[model samples]
Target: MNDSGRAERRETVAEHKRTIILDAARAVFEAEGLQGASMRMIAKAAGYTPGAIYAYFPSKEHIYAAALGESLERLKAATEAAVATGTPAQRFVAAGLAFFDFYDTNPRDLDLGFYLFRGGIHPQGLSVDLNAELNTKLLATLEPLRVAVLDDGAGADRARVVTADVLAHASGLLLLAHTKRLALFGGDARAMMRTHLCERLARGNTPESG
Candidate 1:
């Protein structure tokens, strides 16, 4: 092969190898958590030699971050899909439920994405651009609430605050529910939490009598 052809082939091979390494990393990170996962284990999972994984990612942290980035992207997509068919409040509740559903079904992934942040490594694989993408997705999900909250002459700044509050509440509820500590409310704790939050937000935005 000519130089250009050889370079193109190398690029294709590298891309394929990278994908394999990432897939393996996801599995390992999910099973072992960030601290326990090793490059050798990831390589074995990917059917590659450990050296091959090193060529793609410098450390287990890098692999962990990549797996987390993919997981977050999946989460963002699921939230977007779940909130597409309801009233703003309904969509908000649906988005929260969807998040919990994703975690319940993929606990390892949830651990990789959120629990790693608690370890203090400042995950580096997720670029600033991807961070912006995630923020944009979040803002889109909150847009309906923004409209609802501001419809009664509320200032833009207050609407932004309300949006942030709603998201924070939902995230906190999910984290609690996932930790099994929210079981005091029984099987439908998530539903009850969502309903309570929606009601609170709705009431907060309602025009009050003088």
Candidate 2:
């Protein structure tokens, strides 16, 4: 009834439409990928006209970026939660496993994180700034694991290396699992991750033998 109430209602409606566009965009991206997907496809998936979708997102690339941003946020939350109750070493392992588990369970999110499209090696329409912003968001999701490695008493360089190792290992494992190739490596991706983290912890604790 009031002007303020009407404005709030409008804001809510706008946000709802934005969410609808993003949800449709995600499915379209997954199906057709960033290079192959179009605004029209996303609009059809969202049950809106192309003009209506444009009111929310300027391009399919922007929609993909927004979807990936949300996925990274969820990943960060999952990593933080897993690292909350463990010892430093345990927390380090927990963070790595959390990363693996997040991608392993959400294969589409993993695809989004990969930053590749159906017909191209790179996303074409994303601006440099937008790509960098998304990269920063993605790396932020791994910050917990890096911090946990540091808390486990590794030096900064060592922590960085360990964090990278975890990310690379998890990515490889998830790729194998997603493509049904994990059976070639004993078929237990999580167990391999656990073992690898434990080995890294042991090496960190071992005294150098001069």
Candidate 3:
């Protein structure tokens, strides 16, 4: 074909190949964990020769980083969508619920992105800046609620501190729930936590009854 048609076909092939590699990498990471997964295994999963995978990803770590980054971006989008139309408090709750839902739906991706591969491990010399970006996005997501809480009499610093604590608690609760450790708490754990956090924030901002 013509030059333009050839270029379009090449781009489509590249995109398809990239997706195949990512899918294979995700499976390998889920099955073998980050440290245990190998490039050969990913190539095998993708039905590509080992050298073919190298054309797309230089190493298993590179593939891992891409997969992890994609997962986090998807999560960020989900959170944004969840809070798009809600009030400040509703948005906050929606963000928390969206995070939990993401973990529930994509546990393997979550494990690879957040739990299994932490700082200090550079796969194929690939490093991801997920933590800083995630933190910034999360803080921005809470900014409206933060201002509202502070305006209700809580100090700005205090609101930030409490928001950080509540977020940490929520993350821990999600991890526990994902791992099935929260079964003992029954099904209302999320409701209980949400109620407790809301009450604490309101109490902290309450004016003296004098």
Which prediction has the highest TM-score against the true structure? 2
Worst 10-residue lDDT window for candidate 2 reads 201-210
Q: Estimate TM-scores for all models.
A: 0.66, 0.91, 0.74
Regarding lDDT, does 1 or 2 come out ahead? 2
Ranking of models by lDDT: 2, 1, 3
Q: Which ranking of candidates, highest TM-score first?
A: 2, 3, 1
Clash count of each predicted structure: 0, 0, 0
Off by over 4 Å in 2: 120-124, 205-210
- Residue pairs clashing in model 1 are none
Which lDDT values do the candidates have, in the order given? 0.68, 0.84, 0.67
What does candidate 3's lDDT look like per residue over 1-210, in tens digits?
A: 999999999999999999998998787777776677888899899999999999988777667667766777777788777766755556555666665667667767657645454333333244546455544555664554565456556666677775676667766776777678899767655675667556654556534311
lDDT of 1 at 207: 35
On residues 11-37, what C-alpha lDDT tens digit does candidate 1 reach at each position? 999988888899877777667766677
Give model 2's clash tally: 0
Candidate 3 lDDT score relative to the true structure? 0.67
Sequence-dependent TM-score of model 2: 0.91
* Candidate 3 Cα misplacement greater than 4 A, ranges: 117-163, 200-210
